[model samples]
Target chain A: MNEEENRPVRWNLDDNGVAELIMCDRERNNLFTDSFIDAFLGALSEIEKERPICLLISGLPDVFSGGADKETLLDLCDGKIVVKDLEISERLVAAPFPIVSAMQGHAVGGGLVIGLCSDVMVLARESRYGAVFMNLGFTPGMGTTELLPMAFGPFIASEMMLGGRMFRGSELAERGVPVNAIVPKADVYRRARRIALQIADKPVDSVYLLKYTLSSEKRKRLIDARRNEDLMHRITFPMPETRRRISEQYNE
Target chain B: MTKEEVIEVIKRNIVENLDDVEADSIDATKSMKEYGANSLDMIEVVSTSMRELNIKIPRSELAELGNIDELADKFMEYINKG
Candidate 1:
């Protein structure tokens, strides 16, 4: 397919001033490829200019995102790119307005962290979520360390990040992760839209102000966590074992 | 079910979850990695196998298993608890 047709992300502002960003690179399961990242950043820029009262991000029916693309990870191992180049997490956290992530499908590694960075998150009971960076023999990145703990409790986040194990959304809900809602997969987008509409109903300036105030602490924590995570990535991403794992273990 | 049966269930699920893998080709002594089962695929296999076996083992407990045989052993441990 041509480049434009291949772009994996798109966004639009509704009449109520609720912007929806949908990622649907089904062929690749929405993994963060170069084109996907470029389209994501471009969409975010447009959405910011529109100044929607709230933004809702969603993905395909079965796979929200697969996180860092396997090719990208291999590049990092080969020194072709740096972890800092993946800037989606920072940009997502920096949006002046609130975000609602409707993760209706499996999300792994940086993918799961993207949902965690949002102001409101709706997960699917049957979809799996994980921080599988360690499974690839690298430390977690994209602000996962801080955001996961903030969303789920520190203890559960520790188990997820350290063990690199997948947890079904139902399992996470049972464990009391502090997400807004965990419903059947069919209802995830609907629930997130409801919350986004509620936010959109508020005065734009008031909603923006409240988002600014509420996310200030989180943004600051993200800055600190990013600094530490960058250091860890530098040390871990280039290891022989890490390279081996990425080469041997990365599927699709 | 016996441990051998558990291994067979795991092997079937591995074939189901991973691309280009065959049930007959899976070696109980080898890690699923040898069959090109990535982390996500492994999780799917484990989850499906657990569901089919009617047991629920914490994923964390299964993370360090070295081979299909070990995974079956772990499943057997949970199954025998009944």
Candidate 2:
């Protein structure tokens, strides 16, 4: 087995109040296991406590996150973990500071959910990403329904979600995905950090106010979308076809 | 577009976007924020007004105009400059 990074999600706060959350659980492909979820929440608590002016979420050299762990889904079915699912995306989206998602490799499913929650996104020109819940044999668990359409508009969002398409960053740039920049793989972090610094340098009060203003529509819509998705997820997770797909995908 | 035409466009945009504010009560000197125009409403005002008038209002320049009169004046300046 390949060794995972000691810290899957590492949080760093600079003196200027720019915080970076690095995801590096390579062994598990950065899947959302119990450990990852605990670390994720703990890191977010620290970020809230530290009151960073802006946030940057990036991943290891070539891989961002693989998405929700199928193992975790089983636990969810067994009632070991209660899934308040959408709140995860909401927390990042509603964070007081501006967020910049710097994507390297591919961010899919829950990973894509997190990226879309941020205010601005920058993808490595060579990397790929997708909202592939359909491939996982379930309706979208995260608030991707609203986030996808919000980021890419109705027509593109429809094709991506319904078709479960994996999109190259350059292709998305060409298709007019509203990403802030499509930089080289090596430059993803640097570019995102620069943008985070620019946001942090602004008046903190107004920065937060503007985030609240801009995100209000999406935030509200996500709350409603999650309520319906919750029912859909519960219903679909137990279906025979869903079980077959999950088993095949994970080779269970 | 004449200054009168520009003013008409701005006023029409405000009335169309903001439901709470009636067109008759849209005082030119008052801030649009006072008329219950939130950030999204203001964005709509800027976009629709610019599109209708066929003028480029840089996003940064939007912060400088506080009231309907000021916005109308800026639009007139842009039209005259063109």
Candidate 3:
């Protein structure tokens, strides 16, 4: 393992050169608000120095995330969060290491897209995944529309997105989405760490290139979609019906 | 399609999407949004309606429509204006 770089992303560099990257913001459901995005980038920059062989991304046990914070979405509507999120997402996708997301609960909208950016995912058997931007009358900004169709195939991905269906690990794994193992929530990290350690033992260069290849197209398209999402959001935000609908939902 | 037909399509969508909502209760006059049809349910209804009827209602409009009455009114308004 390379020397630990100090950053807010809270990296724990084990003796084996395995970096466990736990997201620290409990507020905002750990959704990367603009500030968190900057802090996370700084942290990821620090982690890059050690060139850790593998990464384990874990979060709060119950809600992996509820998606982008309402405030962040508001910021996105105003063009504040989109650029920063795109930068961070690009860096995350380009990292020269295998990322394994340890998911234990519901991951919706942007949160699920970030999880998709990881190379391998280990999920709790009961965890739910969704493309839930539709709930807020918006499309996802993190490039989920393209990523899901590529990962899970068009039919199921369309159902998940257009239908706004939230699927469990069992259902997703059966559909060929690349989750490595489904374990009990209590053991999710344990299994993730075990997988990470195994990867860490491999030749670093081989693993890095393997991950880079898998992540390349998704990363490029994510940045492009970020811009597309920005344009679409701007067009949608000011419509009279959009405001009326939001007001109604808030009252409800 | 008349307003009733549009409402029927939306109702069929809600019934198909909700495992718990019984099919018999989806009266066109009742608001789907009012009877505990959360946002996910609304998405399904909107998507299904678009596919089945070849009519597109912005998901944003689903929020504004409130109940079945408001949605039907909007659909009728869109049709009549055309």
Which docking category, incorrect, acceptable, medium or high, applies to candidate 1? incorrect
User: In CAPRI terms, where does candidate 2 land?
Assistant: incorrect
Q: Please give the RMSD to the true structure for each candidate, in Å.
A: 8.3, 18.9, 7.8
What's the C-alpha lDDT at position B43 in model 2? 59
Per-residue error (Å), model 3, residue A180? 2.0
What order do you get sorting by lDDT, best first? 1, 2, 3
| Residue A66 CA displacement from its true place in model 1, Å | 0.7
- Expressed as tens digits, the lDDT of each residue in A96-177 for candidate 2 is 8888988976787888888888898889765667777886678887888888898878888888788776666766877888
CA lDDT, every model vs. true structure: 0.85, 0.78, 0.70
Lowest summed lDDT across 10 adjacent residues in model 1 chain B is found at: B13-22
Sort all candidates by TM-score, best to worst: 1, 2, 3
Predict model 3's lDDT versus the native.
0.70
Clashing pairs in 1: none
Query: Which model scores highest in DockQ?
Result: 1
Across residues B35-67, which tens digit of lDDT does each residue of candidate 2 receive? 866543575677678878788756666777878
What TM-score does candidate 3 get on C-alpha atoms?
Answer: 0.68
DockQ of each: 0.10, 0.01, 0.06
